[model samples]
Target: MVRTIRHRTMTTNSSKTPSSHATRQQNSNKLSRTKKACFGLMTTVLGLVAIELTLALLGVGRSNADGDPMMGFSKQVPLLERYVDEDGKAWMRTAENKLVWFNDQRFPLTKPANTQRIFCLGGSTTFGRPYDDNTSFAGWLREWLPHVDASSRYEVFNAGGVSYASYRVAAVMEELANHEPDLFIVYTGQNEFLERRTYADFFEQTKAQLWLTGLVSQTRTYAAIDSILRKNAPQESDADSIVLAAEVDERLNHTVGPSDYVRDDEWSDKVREHFKFNIRRMIHIARSANAKILFVVPASNEKDCSPFKPDSEDGSFETGQRSFDAGDFASARAAFQLAIDRDICPLRAPSNFAQFIRDLPESDDVRVLDFESELRNVCIDEHGHDILGEEYFLDHVHPTIDAHRQLSRWLISEMREAGWMAADSIALNELSAETVEGVDQSILGRIDRTAQGIAMRNLAKVMHWAGRFEVAAPRARDAIELLDGDAESQFILADCLRWTGQIDEAVVEFEKGVSAYPTYFRGVQRYGLLLLELGDNDAAREMFSIATLGWPETDPRHWAARFQLSIAHLGACDFESAHRELQECREHTPGDMDVVFAIAEASVGIGEPEKAIELYEQVLDEFPNDVDTHLNLAHTLLSTKQTDRAAGHFATALSLAPDNERAQAGMMVIDQLKQSAE
Candidate 1:
């Protein structure tokens, strides 16, 4: 038994040994293949890295790049080219390609000996919107500094652009820094949410997202790949969540009021974070360039301007205005602040902007100016009001050109304290009417003579956009008086009056300008529609005539005006005229269903039953499920004594619209007719 067991064990061992050696050989081959695959992957990765590095060194994707994690902050250099004049002086002027939103101002690029350059940067206020930079605070400084300090030359450049948020201002600062800036005066905060932007994807402010953004934002290789992918990407881009457009399309550009805005808490938080981040980052940028920076606390016409979009449905902003009227200043301020905080369309920056600036640590290169307090003091001292309003401001946030002078004087005080440039001590008494900048007009009168009137007109226009018709109307009227009833001002006035429910007044304003400019017909057409709504057919007809008179027949407005005229004719019960106008409208818009329906209704009113029946049947053939068309055809058939056809049409109308009162009544009338015949 032992000999048999040993023989079996030796035979089993010999078979198992051959199988083990075969398995070992197979394992060795698999391991060698795995090593080759790993080597190939590492080689491919290293080769791709080398290619990326080579492309990066060649500057494949480096333009408009800031230290923007996620690359959502699009930084653009100004469209300025440096040139040397015949006098061996370098200068930089606004490029021709610069959009209409920016100013056409020029400044010296090469600094003269012992000269200090002061850059005034912000949004429309700094740009002096409604007029130009000549009326801005920087304009006051440019004129005032020359007269006050004749010892040293001071160069003040207006680098402000319209609707420029702080991030955009920082972009401008980056460009200005390259030209040897000595000091930068920033007076931003308003217009934070003026532009529309999105970061819905990869924007939860997560640690992992931030880390990836930081890594990707710094790499030229990533940007190059992104650019290639962007060119091949679909029209609806996924990269929008991590990229910002170079140009801004302001919220007020396409519509009226805050219709485009919504109550987005997350978006607001993002804006707040970006706002602070941009301003704080500017400090480092300025310090790196050995330039001093002063940030001014922005103020708004909180009491005068109603909220663009109220948070509450119960008129919280209106209630706040009523409180101010009732002499409750404390409650009024609180309400106004709340309105600003909860405003859906944040055209004006919130109070947190001021708080952020105040909280910033001050140093030799960084300082803060309290322009809000200065404006409040001015209002209380002269106007007997603690809250700033129209007395100090022209619109929501822009200070009047007169107020701009005082603001510049305060800036001079701040600059002098900081020992910047040749700024000397300036008193309120010294900046009188006879001062160098304070001539018969404000600082801007040297540029545009009609700037004040234009400012008032612009003010009225924006107020209308904000849905403050009452505030808009008076400013519009003032603009008319100053502009001598210019067509643009008259049109704006009419718009304001129409919104305020003053139909008669609006008509007068509209008519005053319609004959002068044919293009003013757009306003006339709108008012004519308004009159039609108010049942003033004669006035509407007159407006339609004005809208259509001498206009090109091929133009779309001619057909539209004719259609409106037909409606007015129908309103006056002029069936023949309505038919004629609708026929002409159909010639221009042959496929228009509205014109076809109108012609059918006009034929019925004209007592042409066969013609009306033919048109109604044509409409029924196209829209077989249309309950209104079936009801109209049934009524026409009943009028023509086609009882069977009328009954069928009524049945169809009833089926299509069971709950329709007209369809039910028509069906009942058809049943009654059939019962009477029986």
Candidate 2:
């Protein structure tokens, strides 16, 4: 006989039946209900599968206009599916109002026969962060290209993205194979530690999972869903929304976010390994596609800007700390320098990563542009030590706007030397130092105030991440003041206020952020969470509900809001309401293992073990490495007297998360069952 599932809080009929026939009728009704639920679930799954297949077949949601997939951090980069030229070429208008090629520039869908195309790939530095494309090194290179090679129409596309690590660049290069790229110039490695996305995590995914993620990412469904989940108030102005994108997408803001800190040597080793492999893979991909590669060694502010993360407690670092505490500034500086050189684990890449980059060129087909050395040579102090202070760098790694201009001049020289451009070109001498400096300053003047605000907020966030809260908080205020009505700056200010123990003030700023932009998820979600912390569950629920009301039905944030609301309901012992919310969340995030498990918990709460079992199984298939899913599935199987199957899952859960109390208890239960059976 199957064991009965214990329902939480819900009262059921406990009165005795009138007769045997009445009892039999009740059993038949239960069977019918179970079958109906199963059939409904199956139908939903089948329908989704059919839709996915059809969309894939039609190629309705694939590459952007430039044939690149939507970039990572999809929300930051907006897709302009709105514009299609007469030739059917899709164009993406950025938050800056510049209608650029989907990935780089708007050109013919096919490369023009008379054009010599050179593609530059990197992270925010290459993308010209805190400034527009006109001020970028790539922009400088584009103008210089025609000077050196007047015979051909030069096309230098800057294929850089904000926060794109080397692995992402590798993926882009792999896709560039079909585009007939004449030359591929890479200037990455700075962001490798920023995002730390590995090849396995970034590219190695099941075909089905990839298809689903890619399809949703490429379609406008996600944007609509994001808007809905954000509770984008219909009354919000377009200008306000545009400002939100700049603030949110500002690379400086992430100087201390998720990918900023590295704790140990093991993790550092993994990131370094991935970086090496990705760069090699990128070169191979370009070479195989018949494109010559110019790998630029990335540089940073080593002497002046403090390390984004604390150095590992190696002997040298410990000695440096001791020297500093002893008031020996000279010894301390030397020791600190040694620590930086010897520290086994650092957030930003050490000198060795640069060395590897400089050594990338081995043959005529490949060459290295040593910007790392060039920056060091020009940034030296009278004492003969390398000095990279605020004058040269905007922050820890990003260069000042002036540096970008000089970088372009250096790259031009390297191009001439590498035979990429003819040395005899009359324009080589025409690119005078005075001319480049004048151009750089001119572009700096053209930069929008809002862009300047973004740079400030980013710098503020980095300071906050570095634990200089006192410094960061005021800068955040300045950012909001600089860019009036900017919701992103307001959000950052609120974050700073919250960290500084100014709870009420934080709430006010968060409210302002949400008011400025209705569909801003960070503002809404953070505000709701703060309310929850303050014991305002009712208010939190209302906020989350309003957020989900207009959001895409399938958005992850929609499901996230529902899940949180469900938890709140569950805490209040409102099991029925909790179950309802969980069901809705599951529908929205059907592919999400967490949502699936949450629904399973709801099924268990409502005294439906079979349903819980089915949901848990689905979760397992999606996330095989998830110990909690395996543990939950084992518990469900054990409740149903499936001891043998339960034991296997229990073992898997134990293997995945050793010393887990639940898995240990589950093992004991399985052992007792085995002994009893014997």
Candidate 3:
């Protein structure tokens, strides 16, 4: 209804003040200034981003030496083309670096029209350590594939690297996609912990952060920044430096020691997530490239090898050790599993990682090869234990040559189930002796004594790490004999000699070892330590100095070099030099009780009893059970006429070790002093 409305004007007298109008004007000006500042800042940021992107695309501001966006990467990649060698055997460079070859197998430039090419990817286990390529499962599979179907052609490529984890494998898969692989077999999970990333570097990355990282990882600027960052990173210890060569490639070696075992739930969560992501990405890539994929859940030696880094808070490791000592293998296996799950630094993948792998095939349209379970079952039948040990595994992760053969048998069945092989052509029973011989001739049977010895030496190192020195010594001796003066074998033999109490023989071997590998610092350092043990202080000092001279200052072993030098100086009675070296060691490793004790020993040698006492007391606070430290402290206290304190320490030492002669003598002296005073 269009009704007439009446408007009432009610204007207040207070509504139109000059002061209020001026305040309103001031507020409007402030808002305008804020908006202008915001706009200017946004414009500046956008301009900078545009400039950076432009420069990046133009290759103007490269961060890496190769004009690559990522730092520390070399642009000089090796030609990875297949070529027939003089022996008519096919070979190719597996990596861009000339260091690695495809062992004795080769492929053509293009896949044959009727042939199915399968590429296997993983770490040393897949690479077949302690065994040549012919003995690897992939190598065996290559030979076995032809026997499955005489009319159909099949080819298998062992694309495994020494320490390649999944991330590295993903890159490899991408490269091989161009080579026309019809199928891909991935057996990994153990080597994720092999990379030297910190917990924070892993878990703290958000999805957005990961997206940014993915974008940045493609740029030379990021590469340049990474190189700069690593250049300024802290040095490694002497122990790591001395033992680093035991690995196949130092470039792939872990740069830092694994973190001390802790719950580390955050790190575990991130690693699990990262592993899943990498696997999914790999699967997606393979599928996109029109290749069928098979994932093998890896097996490890749980009952044999101890946890790489045991947790301090968890008692499972101790329980497992006790069970192992008691010879209760079944119980030991369960306890060991607990330790492996809790371990912060597990070089071998725990059962949980395998569980993740087992769960993968359910959600995705891929083939699942449960090699882990089959391996365990075979091990149980052969060894009467659910978990495998040295009989099957070369170490904690690597399988024996025989184990690889067994694995190849199991994988063949899986392939058949996945319909990769012909059902009617040949059964497992039909694999003829002639086919076996040919397989042996082409791939499996060609590992020479020299190669075997090298593999043995690598294997002996794992034994040495596990404290089976007696077992390792014989293998080291065999390596030396077989290799006939190979520098690595000689050095290993010298170490074995020392461990086995052949001191004079070890000294001779050490001298020969250092001479054999003049540039290798480990032999030189070991030679010096051997000489020091034999009381040849002057020779030891010279040897230690030589060991320190040419090594990179940034190497962790630089501090270790200084530590050995200090010991040499102390042995030579060069108190001042020893003190200086100890000071340097302290700066590098402040928490090292060995360095602290060494400093105290030098103080005592120089007749600074008060300083010696102070240092000893500091050490005792941290390690009260140290018998030698207790004896030293007691003597110092007695020298200063602190009889009661000295007596207490003497008694404590005797309680710790009843056969301590020095402690016994000190106690007798204390009794005499008390009797005389009374």
Candidate 4:
């Protein structure tokens, strides 16, 4: 029995041996595959990293932009720059201070103990246009802070920039947070339309794509690859919709204000949305830095300031004017409000600004001051009319000196109410008119009649630019009464007359305004233009020469003056000088078709028929139906003995403008040339 049991045990052991060997072999194969997969992945990753590093080192994907990069902007921009001085101390200042955007400000690298650093932010109203910071609310706050608070040494920074929109203010606020700001007093709204940026396909991006893009954007490798692809791909060069210029390009200010703007309700709605975004962004930035934020509800001179750009038809603007004329103040007010609400170019703070401020969900760190209503109440008390104007405002939105004082006092009161300032000191509040009026307060001196006159003329010029000739004429007259010898008012009034078809009256005014400005002046420029129109080429040449001489090449006015001078040269048939001036202007504004056309005309006059023909071809390609271009090209071709080509252009010009005198002349010349050939 023991021998039989041993044989069975030996057979069972032999059967299990083969099964164990098969299982072991299977497990070994699985482990080997895993090792191979891991090795392949590691090699691929190494190769990718090597390629990425190589592209990054080549500097393939880099772009230079100015101002603060925000909200889907790929371009890198910085507002504030940190610089170390010779004394081994770091200071912070606005980059490119000479741009005249931001008021001059200096802050140390480190925040001081027992120091309350206040930053006042906003648009041109905050920057104090027609005057400067001293007369602005920011300036008043700096001076008045000492009376209101004593515990902390107050350092009020005028962070207000000229033509700065709410977006720019928010961008600046972001930078101020890094400087250890105790408080940020934001006073924006008037300049929302001054600068704009469109985020190309920002909202259209899928969440996954956004996430992936955000991740890759952080890497130099991705930027390089994107740059390379963009360079290689056939695409529109200026297709991207981001506004990258460091300074605000106020559209109305740059272009013929009347021609550039039209009622685009969609764009207006977008602007309102952006205004809200900027306010929320500022709040977020303040909270992130643990800084206190206060928003000032901005006011507008609705009842006083006329609609800058009125509709062509007699519409709400006319109704408002009639209402005001009829002494129906209530109806006038309503109509005026409607006009501003429907305004195509809203340089003044829109009604939505006040609503936006009041709508912000107030938190412990956030504060809102309804200064708009406060200003109106003050207007009611002082002027017996609730409508604010020259009584408390310099222009549409810029507050007068006394209004700035009122703003400062109100801000102090708000500070005390918010418990930001410990004491409600009566010292600043009790300031009698004698103390302020008696002393020469700011560097520019107390708001004198000269300053007021300058501001008035400025207002008139803006009105004139906007094609509001009727209102601008009266304002210019008022400015002249105050300024006496001021040429700006004179020229603006002259322009009003000229535009109104009173040629003789305009000529008289233009003559009076000539040679008024010592340096560059709008009046002098306008006078030169009038001279050009009147065929006084020598006088026009002299006027433009003076205008361009003083300003640096960096100033747009310098190039503009040069352009005018070139036209003046053309008027005198001085082809060489005209060509030189146009060439210089071309250097400034390369794509200006007006300059190109003028250059072509000058080339023709200078006996370069072939060059003129080439330039005319370029212009005709872009503006095929342009009668002037066709006629000019025809004339140029005729000079080059290209009768067939000349006849073709002349025929086209006649078709486009049958009554065009120059086109008629060109056609007659072409017919004569063909007949001579026959």
Per-residue alpha-carbon lDDT of candidate 1 for residues 277-349, written as tens digits (9 for 90 to 100): 7897678668767899999999887877777877766465676788889988777777887787778888777
Tell me the deviation in Å of residue 392 in model 2: 1.7
- TM-score, prediction 3: 0.62
TM-score ranking, high to low: 1, 3, 4, 2
The candidate 4 region of ten consecutive residues with least summed lDDT is 62-71
Worst-scoring 10-residue span by lDDT in model 3: 65-74
Which regions in candidate 2 have their CA more than 4 angstroms from the true location? 1-104, 194-264, 312-347, 381-384, 427-429, 432-438, 465-678
Which candidate comes out best when scored by TM-score? 1
Question: How accurate locally, in lDDT, is each candidate?
Answer: 0.79, 0.66, 0.73, 0.76
Q: Select the stronger candidate by lDDT from 1 and 2.
A: 1
In model 3, the runs with Cα more than 4 Å from the true position are 1-106, 198-263, 313-329, 362-365, 441-444, 462-678
Per-residue lDDT tens digits for candidate 3, residues 303-406, read 65666567777878668778877878778888888877876667788788888888886323377788878887887788676656667776678887777877
lDDT of 1: 0.79
TM-score of each: 0.76, 0.48, 0.62, 0.61
